[model samples]
Target: MSKKERKLSAAEQRRKEKFLEKCSTMETEGYRMENLSFSVLQINLLSVFIALPVNFLFMFSYFLFNDFSLRSVYLPYAPLLFLLIFLLLIVVHEAIHGITWGYFAPDGRKSIEYGVIWQALTPYCTCSSPLTKKQYFWGALMPTIILGFLPGIIAIITGWEPLFFVSQFMILAGAGDFLIVARLLLHRPKNAQVIYLDHPYECGLVAFLKNID
Candidate 1:
């Protein structure tokens, strides 16, 4: 963390201080740590491009075999109910992040936290403990799989518009997370055992690498 990054959030700075000590100790034990984090603007911009292909592919395929149907079935007060479910799924998305990461966290659920960014109205879950690569990948990805792709695929096959829209929207909503996951996938350190930690101040992660024997 730089001096500019340090001055912005005192609480984040405190966390940064603690982690720096930990990194120093690990460095002595032959581990190297680096900032693998992206800025807020970058994540936001990346999200748009990431979401486009996913939504376009699903939408295009669905339209090839089916009509653009918003009402596949009738429900009482359909618009209101759709709105309600939309809001509810947003909470579920964050919960899945917390739950999956907490399951792998060293401190388990004790290290997990849920918070909202009031300025952007984005809800997020974070795990304070470090995670192995496998653990981190799943925690970063399960929401997109469970709530997004699974349902979206089902909708495409079964011709359910509500499920299709909800799933696609959730997929779009998780674009930032997908970008983070993509970073891990593309930039892995060679011959190193890797660990990733949730970044408190940004939509990113910190990486620690230890060379394998």
Candidate 2:
């Protein structure tokens, strides 16, 4: 979000501005929302560090049944095939977020926007509609669960080398999502109603809260 504005279209810029204005208005009205968004640098760093343990767990589970010495570094597919799958999975990762959130959004998929930060090659899906705590948390974690944990479990049982490795990478890729969900989990609002709105230009969500009288 910090420098993502440089790549935004004029209309996108206006949309971000409008969102900021709305946030300001909400604060003035005593309906302030907490900003939980992180910068690109922060998310990237979290992605690496936070996901390492998850990957290690997968590997440890695999080791429980199989001999570690028999593990091979060689993936079954050719370089080209592996590359295609890697790129496709990246797209699927964001698509999972969009589809999950869209299902619960008031306006459906229309509220979702997908784009890439060309400079950093970071692809993101943003949701305009607000969502419940469960909705946001599940939506954020869906990709990791689907692409990472499930495949990893299966690969460990079947001894599929490629799948286990892919699971590791996908889990790592979901670190940012994990961090966002973590923020949501730790936040506590007393006597206030809350809904999460994905920040259009940032790497996290805004938790809009209104106190009950």
lDDT, residue 191, candidate 2: 93
TM-score for candidate 1: 0.86
For residues 68-166, write the lDDT of model 2, one tens digit per residue.
543345546555666777789999999999999999999999999888866567899988888899999999999999999999999989988778777
Cand. 1 Cα-lDDT: 0.81
In order of appearance, the predictions have TM-scores of 0.86, 0.89
Best by lDDT: 2
C-alpha RMSD of each candidate structure in angstroms: 3.0, 2.5
Instruction: Please estimate how well model 2 matches the true structure, expressed as its whole-model Cα lDDT.
Output: 0.84
Model 2, 83: alpha-carbon shift in Å? 2.4
